[model samples]
Target: MFAAWWKLGFDTTLLAFEAQSVIALRMAKLAAGGTAAQAEAQRMVSEKVLAAGEAAMQLATGASHGAVVAGYRRKVRANHRRLSRGAKAI
Candidate 1:
């Protein structure tokens, strides 16, 4: 009876060890794949953010230029009006 118990115990231990090894290998594979995917996702997001920032900067620059042009045009019109009134008085 004792011998049978020992044999059974040994077999169970061996099977358990094999199962643990397989589980560890699978976990390693999953972790590696997850890490690679995470890196790729981060890189893509960063690229998208960079692109958005560049577009926003371009839009802001265009708006500022337009505002300056409009202001300059208003100033020129005012100057012309003043000169015309002065000429009429003279």
Candidate 2:
């Protein structure tokens, strides 16, 4: 549903970002509730899960016909870079 709609130009990138953010928050929660070793393991597993999700989203969006998803991803990376630089200036 989301991937298809996103392919149709429905702000899918934001959805992906939101999903990733939620996963990060969950990772933090797990870290806070566990011993150091447990936390580390949880973090590592969480990172792998997050990375997989990100990769899938990227492939799904990037490999679409006519490069539509790829174009969007490029613009997003450019904007993120700009924002990071701006934050550094602040």
| Best-fitting candidate, scored by lDDT | 2
Per-candidate TM-score against the hidden true structure: 0.34, 0.32
Task: Score each candidate by Cα lDDT.
Answer: 0.50, 0.54
**lDDT (10s digit) by residue, model 1, range 25-50:** 43444355666446645654675476
Cα-based lDDT at residue 8, candidate 1: 55
Off by over 4 Å in 2: 1-34, 63-90
TM-score of 1: 0.34
lDDT tens readout by residue for model 2, 1-90 = 677665656456654674454445445545555474375466557755765576677677765532544544554455455434534543
